[model samples]
Target: MSGPVDPARIRDAIAQFGRTLGPDVLASCRALFGAQQEALSCAVPAAARDLAYGPHERHRLDLYGAAGEAPKPVLLFVHGGAFVGGDKGDPSDPARWHNGAVGRMAARRGWIGAVMNYRLAPDHPWPAGAQDVGAAVDFLRAHAADHGGDPDRIVIMGTSAGAAHVGGFLRLRPDHADLVRGAILLSGLYGITPLEPKDEEYYGAADSACDKSPLEALASTPLPMMMACAQYDPARFQAEYLGLLQKRLTRHGALPCSMSLPGHNHYTIAMHLGTSDRRLEDSIAEFCDRLFA
Candidate 1:
């Protein structure tokens, strides 16, 4: 087992960046977390890669510990790239020990862990990601037993743009409620506010974006959920997180499980999974256990 992550060390490494979200900060944190994941390279089970969930080239998913026992709860993860770009694995590294580390962590905890890629924006546009998510869910549900997963106990987790897609699925495909047991959203654009520029590339102009926003729908949905934002995330994501909390509270009279991850930022928040940092991972496992129970 890996040792616990040193929050102090992570804080010092990014102190100079100071809450900025950009290539420099993202690169720095990627390298740091990549190294942490690399150290556990020998521990994670090999993943079954590039399984097609749809006809599109990007409709692919990788599953870890998939050939194991029967009826394990499913944990599907969606990676974020602001809707313009992102992948389930680090493109440059074939070993893929970094970006998809969360899936490996889920496998370690005895769940069928999945990481997937979806169609990008400017070409696919609004609802495409959600459509891909729906396809993935369908594929997983159909083959869950073959892959040692429980089709009915699936939980989808997403970060940033990925979270938007999950929220979109919830809003647009509420009929799938019986298939998905819960959700975890990290720093996603929930449509509580206007779309950012990069997001507009996916959601389109103001009117279209508003029409496609999932905030109102997600607020009223009764799905079990857990949400959080990084302590050092930019203001927009912070606002989105707060917006969802307030909306859910006002609409449902209660808040979903949530947290402000300390000593981390947007990138490191997800990157640190499987790296001895049990804070977020532990919470996710607890949430899953509660739902799967």
Candidate 2:
């Protein structure tokens, strides 16, 4: 039998296909990505909790934890679905990578893991989605005591589109600053610039949407942050955007810890957090520990 699979080669293959494939075919590609995640060997336990924030439909928060009485730190996760598709419940499904791996891993680590669903795109749009996330945070804070969580020690984590929502939350509602002690943003999109020529309908014009960019929203507030991405991500501009945001943060005297997953692709890097990979998940846990320490 051959040696273990090479993550670099896997990333390169995905990036190549992303460049060659049309936008409509991306969903199928994403499904393939999910399939890859499900094949990994890891076990974590998760539970479902449903609650209503306001007039919106009852949202679900997936909780993960080891069976113990320890009052662990809370990690609130928001999944990326391009502001169009994706459910917190979907990630928790056994068929998917994100819900199965990451959510379970967080719980196994003695954290009160919470993955929540927010309103999607077109039907919801920018701030609406961010507001939904904010409400989830509020709900968690209000009920953390009941869930055996320390409301003062909460970390907001997100990937891709979900990361954008976290960024928006930080920018739009500074009052909620106390609600989150730190953030973990993975392969996230921060700039409001369109990813494609026809993406203007969803992302809006770049010039006028500058305020919507996380980089811009971060100009005044200096929250501790950790930004990460994969080297072989087809979305190369995401790295560039992170760099720009880093530079801005530096100029504003706010330096964020950052990392580039050496051999992983965008999908793999994001999903790896769900695995027992000490290299990634441990680092994230360490970061949060220090932030709340």
Task: Please report, as a residue range, the 10-residue window in candidate 1 with the lowest summed lDDT.
Answer: 90-99
Tens-place lDDT per residue, model 2, 1-293, is 02454556545556665433244444444454454345442344455555565566635676766435756788888887666766664444644445445566667667788887787766666677677778889887887767677778889988777888888888778785678888888877776344553333345665555556766654455667787776666555455456646665667665677777665555556555553345778778788889767
Alpha carbon deviation, residue 147, candidate 2 (Å): 1.6
Model 2: worst 10 consecutive residues (lDDT sum): 19-28
Q: TM-score for all predictions?
A: 0.94, 0.81
Give lDDT: candidate 1, residue 122.
89
Clash pairs, candidate 2, are 64-107, 65-107, 83-121, 91-99, 101-274, 102-274
RMSD per candidate (Å) reads: 2.4, 3.8
Model 1 scores what on Cα lDDT? 0.84
TM-score of candidate 2 to 2 decimals: 0.81
In terms of TM-score, which candidate is strongest?
1
lDDT of each: 0.84, 0.66
